[model samples]
Target: MKGKNIRLLRYAVQYWFLLFCIYIGYRFYLFVRHFETGGVSPFVSRPPSVEGFLPIAGFMSFKYFVLTGIIEPIHPAALFLFMAAVAVSLFFKKGFCGWICPVGTVSQSLWMAGERITGRNFRLPRWVDIPLRAVKYLAMGFFLVMIGLIIRTSMMVLFFITDYYKIVDVRTMKFFTEMSTATAVFLVVVGLMSIFYKNVWCRYLCPYGALLELVSKLSPARIRRNKKACINCGSCSKHCPALIDVQHSESVSSAECFGCLTCVSYCKGEGALQMTVKIPKKGIRSVRPVFYVVALLIVFYSFVFVAKVTNHWASGVSYQEYMKLLSKQGPTQREHPRLP
Candidate 1:
C-alpha cells in the first residue's frame, strides 16, 4: 500500500498524456494527408499541439520574440509548450518528465516490459554509468553553443523565414511515415537498449532532459528525508529510478531526481520521505503529491490559454500554402522561394 499511490499516479499521467499525443499526431496526419493527396481528401484543421515536437523552432521563436517583441507567425504553439515545460521544471523539479513527456512514458514502459521478461533490471558499472550520463550534458552544451550563443537575431530571422523552416513540420511527419532503413535500425537499437536498462535514452542521450535538469536545480520543492523516522531499510533507494541513495541523504537534491515520488511512496517507515518546500530560515513544509500535480496542470494550461487569447496559438500559414508545399512527391522536392 505504501508504494501503490506513486505507481497509480505515474501510470495515470503517462497513459493520459500518451493518448493525448496520439490524438494530436492523428489530427496532424490528417491535416497533412489532405495536402499530400492534392486536397482531394476531406480537410482537417491542423492541431497546433503538433508543434510541440519542434523544440528547436521553439527556441528560435522564443529568441525572435525576445528580440522583436512579437510571437513568430510560424509554430507559435512550440514556444508556449517550451515555456510551459521550463516553468514546470523551475517550480516542480522536472515534474514534466515524470508526469507528461510521451518519450519518458515509452521509455518507462520498455524497461518495465524488460523486467517482466528478465525478472529484473540491470545497472551498468559505476565507471560506465558516470561517463554515459555525461553524454546528455555534452549534447545540451552543443545545442546551447549553436542556438543560444552563435545564432544572432538576424540569422534566426533569416532561417525562420526560409522554405526549409516553413515546411519543417511536414518533413518531420514524412520522416516517420517514410522511415529509412538506417533510421529504423537506430530506433530499434534504442528501443532494445531501453528494455535492458531503465530510461536508457533519457539518462544517456536526451539533451532536452539535460536542459530540464539544469532548470530543476532552481526548484524549491524537493524530496526530503526525515532521518529520525527512517528505519535503516534501503527500500526507497532500491526503487528509485534515478539511482539516488535515498536512505543516506537528508534531501534528494540531485538534478537526476525526476520528482516521480517513487522514493517517497516506497518508504515503509511513516514520515520517512516526503516532498517539501524549503523556506529561507523558516524550515520546510510538506507538499502533497496532489498539489504538485495540480500546480503543473495549472501552469501548463494557463500558458496555453494566454497564447490563445493573445492570438499566438495558431500558425499563420494557411491550408493552401501547405497544399502547395506538400503537393510535391518527396520532402526534398517541396520548396518555397528563399528569402534573399
Candidate 2:
C-alpha cells in the first residue's frame, strides 16, 4: 500500500510535467504558425521553456560561455535549462531524467503500457546489455570531442551568431511535424522497441542521460541497505527499474542508479532500504522521499529564478525579430538561413 502511494505520487508528478510539456508544445506550435501564416494566425508569445529541447544548443552555449564569458543571447534559456538539469543530477541523481524529462515520461509510459498489454516488459541479457549501455556514453563523448575541436578552430562564435542558429528551434518543430519517410520509420522502430524493452532510447541512445549519469557519479547520495532490517525478500531488486541488485548490494551507487527510489519504496521490510546522503562528520543519513522531492524542485527552480532575475531567461531576439528571420519560411520550408 505504501509502495503504491509512492508510485502514485511519482505518477502525479510525471504527468503534471508531461502536461506542462504538451502545453508548451501547443503554444510553441501557435507561435510558429503566427509566423508561418504571415500574420494571419493569432500570435502567441514563444515560451522560453521550449528551449529545453535544445540541449545541444545548450551544450554549445555552455562552451561559448566558457570560452568568451558571454551567454548566447539567441537561446539564453537553453543555457539555464541545461544548468538546472545538470544541477538536479549533481544533487539528486538524474532527477531531471527520472522526474521532469518528457522523453523519460514517455519511455516510462510506453513500458508501463507494454506491461499492461503484454503482461511484462523484457530485459536484455547481461552480455548483450553492457556494451549497448555504453552507446550513450560513446555518443556523448563524440559530441563533446567534436565541440572541443570546434572551439579550438574558433568557429564557435560564428556558428552561434548564424541565422541558422537563431531559427533552429523552428527546424526542430518541423522535424516532428513534417517527418520524412526515413524519420518516420526511425521513430516507429524506436517506439516499438521502447514497448518491448524498458527505456530503449533512454538506456541506449540518450547522450543527455549519459551526461547526467556522469555528473551523478559524484553525488554522495545513494540507495543504502541495512542488513538487520532486511527480510531478504528480494522485492527491492525485482522492483528496481534500473535493475540494480538492491537486495544484496550494500550500496547502489552505480551510474544506472538514477535515484528514482523504487527500491526503497518497494522494499518489503520497513527500514531495509533507504535513500541516504553522506554528510560531513554526520555519517550517512536517510533522506525521506518528500524531502528529496522538495530539494530537487527547489534546486531546479532556483536556477530558473536566478536566470529570470539576471535577465537571462529570455532570448534577446524579440517576436518581431523572429518574424523577420522566419519571414520566408513556409509550411514545407527546408532551408534554414545559413551563417549571416
Candidate 3:
C-alpha cells in the first residue's frame, strides 16, 4: 500500500510538471507564430470586428501581464491560478513547485544535462548559498515598492488606462517584431545561465515565486517529517530541488521549500514525511530571522511605492493617442497598443 501511494504521488507530480511546460510552451509558440507570420497566433482568436488578435484579456498576473502590457486588474483566470496554487499547496504540500513551475522543470533539465556531461554533481557551499538566497527577498521588496504601491496608485493608473496603451504603437511593434540584437543576446545569456546554475534566476531572482513562497508558508498544507520513524539518511535533502533540509525539520521551511514531492518520494520509510494541515504556535511563525525582515520590507516599501505612483512619474504612455499616432502613420489599424 505504501509503495503504491508513493508511486501515485510521483506520477501526479510528473503529470502536473509536464502540463505546466506544455502550457507555457504553447504561449511562447503563439508569440513566435505571430512574430514570424505577421498574423495572429493560433492560440489567440479574433472576432470578426477585431481584425487581428483579440485584446489581451483575462488574468491579473502582474509578472507576466505587466511585461506584456498594462496590467488589467486581477482577471478570473489569474485568480483561479492563484487559488489553485493555494489549494494544491494545502492538500499536497508544495506540489506546485514539484509539478507546476516551468522554471523548476528547466532547472531539472539543466541538472540532467550537467550530469550527462560531467561525471560529478554541482553543489554550492553554505557560505555562498545562504547569502545568495537573500536575493529573492530583495527582488520581491523592489517589486512591492515599485508596483504594488507607487505605480498602482499613480503611474500605473495612467498607463493601464492611457499612456501604456499607446507606447506599443506601430513603431514599437516594428522594433519588437525585429527584436534588437541586444534583446537576443540577453535571452541567450539567460539560457546559458540556466545551464550552469541549478536555478540561477528562479532561486535568487523571481519575485513572483518569492510572493508565492510567502503565501505558501501560511498555507495549512505542509511537509511533516517524523524524526522517530527513520534512519538519518539524507536522501530527502539530496533530492530536494529547492535544496531544503527536509530531514532535519518537522515542518519544512516554507521560504525554501518548493513543496516538491522529491523528499517524500525519496524517503525510504513509510510515513517518514507526509503532507498535512496544522497551525504553528504563535511565536513559531516569526521564529525565522528572514521572516521578520521580509515582513518589515513589505510594509516599509509598500508606502514608498504608493508615494511614487501618486507623484505621476511612472514610465507608461497612453493608449488612445498611441492609436491616433499609428493611424496617422499608416493603415495599420489592426495593431493594438500594448502596455509596457
Candidate 4:
C-alpha cells in the first residue's frame, strides 16, 4: 500500500509539471496576440466552411499556410516541430495523448465519473475495438490523399492565391469570446461525447492521432514483457486505459498505448514489464515519472516556440484587410479569397 501511494505521488508530480507547461504554451499564444495586435484576436477568422483556400485546419485559430500557395509560404518551423513530435512518440509512445491533451483529460474524468456511478467498468470487446481504430486511419488518408496530395499539389495552388480566400481579420477572437448559439451547441455535444467515452474522439476519430499511431508503432522506447516471470496476473491489461493486453504480448498491442506507465506502476511482478532501450529485462535507470513529465513538456513547448518565432516573419495580417481591399476595387465577391 505504501509503495502504491509513493507511485501515485510520483504520477501526480509529473502531471503537475506537464500541466504547467501547457499553461505556459497557452499563455504564450495569448501574450503574442495581445501584444502584437493590441489583443488576443485571430490573425484570421471566418465561419467554418471549406469554400476558402484556408478552410478550417483544426479547432485552433491557426492554419497551415502550406495548404495554400502564396509566396510559397510554408511554416517550416511547425513542420519540423510536428515531425519531431512524431519522432519522439516513436520512442516514448503517445505521451502526447496521456499527458498533455486537454481532451484526454476530459475523457478520463468522464470515465472515472461513470465508474463511480456504476460499479461495472466499461470495456469494449476486441471486435468493436479493431474496426473502430481503423476510422482514424481512414480519416487521415482522406486528408492526405485529397487535400494534401491532390489539392495542394494541383488546382488549389492556383485557386488559393487569389482574393476570394479572404475571410476575417484580427477581430475574430472577439467573435468567439462571445459565442453564438450554434457554437454553444457544438461545444455541449463535444463535451457530452467526451464524458461518455474514454478518449472516444482521439481513439477512433482524430486524424492527427492516426498519424501519431503510425509513427509510435516504430518507437524504440516501449514496455517489454518478461515471459519468464510467468505470473500472467493480467492486472496490466485491466489498468491500461487504452484497453491493450499488455500482459500477453511482448510489445504493447495497440497504437493507443500512451506510455502513461500506469501498467508499470501497477505491475507487482518483479522485472515483468519495464521500459528499455533494447527491451531490457529491466529498462533504463532514470526516473520514469520525470521522463514522462519532460516528454510532455517538450511536445507542448516545441509547438509554442515555433509559433512565436513564425509570428515575427508572418504577414500575420488578417483576411479582413484583403476583403476590404477587394470590396473597394469592385463588386462584393462572396467567394472566399485564396491565400494572398
Off by over 4 Å in 3: 1-94, 152-155, 163-193, 279-340
Cα lDDT of model 4 by residue, 213-301, tens digit: 77778766677788887488888887777878898888664788887777877887877777555445764443455555566567656
> How many clashing pairs in candidate 1?
0
* lDDT for 222 (candidate 1): 94
Q: In model 2, which range of ten residues has the least summed lDDT?
A: 331-340
Give candidate 1's error at residue 227 in angstroms: 0.4
Question: Candidate order by lDDT, highest to lowest?
Answer: 1, 2, 4, 3
lDDT, candidate 2, 100-148, per-residue tens: 8889889888888998899988999999999999899999999888886
Candidate no. 1 TM-score: 0.93
Off by over 4 Å in 2: 328-340
lDDT of model number 4: 0.56
Q: Write the per-residue lDDT of candidate 3 for residues 238-336, one digit (tens) a residue.
A: 767677778888878566676555576678876777654455573222112123223323443343344245431122333334334433333233555
TM-score of each: 0.93, 0.93, 0.61, 0.64
The full ranking of all candidates by TM-score, starting with the best, is: 1, 2, 4, 3
Candidate number achieving the greatest lDDT relative to the actual structure: 1
Model 1 alpha-carbon miss at residue 16, Å: 0.6
Candidate 4 C-alpha error for residue 258, in Å: 1.1
Query: How well does candidate 1 score on lDDT at residue 153?
Result: 90
**lDDT: worst 10-residue window of model 4:** 46-55
